[model samples]
Every structure is written in structure tokens, then in C-alpha cells.
Target: MTESSKSAEAVWAAEPSTLLRVGPHFRLSDVDPAATPGFDGDEADGKRELRRTNSELADLQERLWAESRFGGERSVLLLLQAMDTAGKGGILRHVVGGVDPQGISIHAFKAPTEAEKAHDFLWRVRRELPAAGMIGVFDRSHYEDVLIHRVRGFSPPDVIERRYGMINDFESQVEQAGTSIIKVMLHISHDEQKRRLSQRLERPEKNWKYNPGDVDERMFWPDYMDAYQAAFERTSTDVASWHVVPADHKWYARVAVQRLLLQTLREIDPHWPAANYDVEFEKKRLAAS
Candidate 1:
């Protein structure tokens, strides 16, 4: 295993909480996109471990679902933020797709509609929050309000500045209400992004995935990085800290995310809810029938 992968394995096996955690001191430039921080394995090993992690995640999700049916209060929300072509869809398909669909709620936020724009930025976000005992995944979340808005100058400087505190407060409120948040920023290098974008152009089947706007956005990559760095500094709070996953290696990214989810679920430690009825009476009644 590579030294980076060995380090990754240690992080996941021991203190997974600190794995890729972003803080006020976080520098986006300091992270190495090619480095695999937690798993001690090759691609094949990653795939195998991912399958195992998926099994555990699926079981935990089912238990959480059952607990919710019995009026449990806790749930989990995974908010994914990344630059284009950073493997958000892959994470969805490989990691989250393994879980029971009934226990998972996924929302892919796009440009707001006319009606949606009438309200505050978080109005739509508030509507999409997962209910008790479920796992929610946000493809692109309220962070977009800060990221895109900041990079493209869509929102005023003062308003964008205010949103940092607003987001922190909002997340704190959600945590207080029993929702554990796992926020991830999939970090990829500029060269890797170019390679992925080129593949989109070369493969006929992937042509649809290419957006002209993606190229236009690339011009502002530096600005966007600055915006993300500012966001991490302001919004990486105790309630919902950000995890910056190195995403150049798709396999490593998938495994790291799976491990992060497993760690969160482990902390939640949901159990199957106890039956509320008398087992002997129900068995006897059923036998009579």
C-alpha cells in the first residue's frame, strides 16, 4: 500500500472522525487530490471493502428506518459539495445506492424556479430535510448559495457574508433537532478535472454530461477555490464540519465516503425497535386463524 493509503487506513480504522475534517485552519491548497488518506488497499481491495461497508450501511439504514417507524428522533443528512466532474454521481451510485431506497431520501438541487426564488435561500432546503430515522443526501446543497453566488457575483458581498453565519446557525438548529450532518467537499485537481471533461467529449455516450457552462465556470476556478476556502473557515462548525475528500482516484473517493458514512452510522448506533405487542397472544391468535 502507498504511504498515503496506509495513513488513510489508520484514519478510518482508528480516528475516523478526524479523517479529512476541515477547520478554520484548513487550506484547500494544502490537500493533495491524488493522496488516498484512509484505506490501505488497491482498487480491487477498495471495491471489496466498499461492498462490506455497504452491507453494514444497509443494515444500519434498515434499523434506523424501523426505529423511525417506532417514533425515533434521529436522522442523518449527507451534504455533498464539489466542483464539476468531481464524482458526486459516482458516490451516489456506489455508496448510497447500496442502501434501501425506502430508508434514503436524495435531493439534487438545481437552479431555483421562479416560485422557489421568491422565498429565502434556505426555504427550499428546509423543505427537503429528511424525516426521523432516515438518511438524506443532498447532491448540491445550500452551499451553492454561497459558492456559486460568490464566484459569479450573483449575491451582494454583504449578503454573501451574512450567509456564513446563517448557515452555521441553520445547521446548529438541525443538529439540535436530532439530525446528524455529514458535509463533504470532494476535492479534485485542475488537471484531473480537465481529464474527466475531455473524456466526456471523447465518449459519445457521455456527450450529454458535458455542459457548455462547465467550461465557462472553469475560467473562475481560482475564484471558486477562494470562495470554498472562505466557506470552510466560516461554516466548518461543531454541528456540521466539512470533510474534504481527495477525489482524483474514484475508487478511493468512494471508499472514503463509505467509511465516513459508516463512521456516522456507527456513532448513531441505531437498533431494531422492540415489538410493541404481546408475542404469545399474537402467536396464539394467528394459530387459531
Candidate 2:
């Protein structure tokens, strides 16, 4: 095998969660969106590794679903938070698409509706939690209450400050209910985001993704960074930790996230449940018939 392939194999053999997980003193500013961290692979190698692991990912997902059907209470929730053009859609279409669709539920949160705004921010979120034995994905999660609300001043400063603790409590509750949360922030550079936005404008096929409000949000990039940094400090808890993946390189980001999922599933270690009924009795009855 080529050296790059050897390196990629080593990455798979190693613990990716240790490399990517957010620590108590983690700083979003310290992350470089272009760096690959634990993987020494190039784009081609990364993509190949991602494909190579799909079967394992699929198998683990099927096992989780099977275990759930047999009264297993465990489930997994992958919360993806990123800026516009940070490739959240690509992660869903590529990484997540590799798994069985029946075993997954994906929810993309947008601006709250009139009815939704009438209740607490997490009220809508609770309704979308995945059932036992399934995997749940959130495109942009309750972090928006602190992120955009903090940047845009939708909520008062004190209210937004309170949400950090509230979110920690909420996540702890979810963990107690048997959902393992894997929170990831797709970190991208300012120039990379601008380049992606410009590409969308330049390509007729990508025009639909171009939003005028995206430019409006770009002005608050610094504020958003501060908000995310604060979130890392307050909410990256033992129940559910945050992972920052360098997303300037889409291939690396995809591979890193795939590794994260693999790590979590392996830890959960759901097995193909033992047959509850007698196989010999069923076979004998069928033969008699």
C-alpha cells in the first residue's frame, strides 16, 4: 500500500475522539480549519478511507436498530453546527447517506415559527428526538438560541447567558434518557467561507443556495466566534462533548466525522441480539407443516 494509505489505516486504528473532542479549556480560535489533526492523509486518501469505513458504519447502525427492537434503550444523536457553506449538507448526503435510512432521522432547524416561538426553545427540539435504536441528526440545533440570538440580540443578554446552563441540563437529561449526543462544530476559515459563497454566486446550478441574508450574517463572524467559544466553555460536558472538525478541506471533514460516528458506535457496542425464541422448535414445526 502507498504511504498515505498506511497513514489513513493507522488513523482508523487509533482513537479519533481523543484528537477531536473539545476539552474544558478548548478555544475555537485555536483551531485551524485547514489542518487535518490526527489524519496524515491527502484528499484522495481521506475520501477512500471514508468509503472504506461505510460498511462498518452500516453494520453498526443495523445492529443498533436491531438491538433497539429487542428492547434496547440506547440511541445516538449527532448534532452538526456550522456556518453557512461549511458543508453540513455534504456531511448528510455523503457520510450519513451511507447508513440505512430507516435507522436514521434528520432534522434541520430553521427560524422558529409563530407557534414554536410561543413555547420554550427546546420544546420543538424534544419532539424530534430519535426513537430507541435509531440515529438522530440535527443540522443546526438549539445552539441557535445562544448563537444567533446572542449575535443578533434576539434575547436579552441575561437570558442568553442563562441558556448555556439550561442547555447543559437539557443535554444531561437526554443522556439519562439513553441518547448519546455527539456535537460537532464544522470549523472553516473566513476566506474559505467567502470563496464558497462566491462559488455559489458564480455557478448557475448553485444559485438556489445563495441567500442574501448569508451576507448579512457574515458581518457578525467575530461575534459568532465569541458565542461559539463561550458555548465550548459552558456546555462541553461529560454527558455530551463538542468536537471541532477542520472543514476547510471537505474530504478531511467528512472522514473525521465518519470516524467520530464509528468511535461512538463502537463504544456503545450494540450487538446482534440473541434469538429470544427457540430456533429448533420453529424449524421442527416448519418441517412438520
What is the model-wide C-alpha lDDT for candidate 1? 0.91
Expressed as tens digits, the lDDT of each residue in 41-80 for candidate 1 is 6788888778866777899988888889998999999999
Tally clashing residue pairs in candidate 2: 0
RMSD of 2: 2.5
lDDT of 2 by residue, 226-256 (tens): 9999888889898899999999999989999
Quick one: best TM-score, which candidate? 2
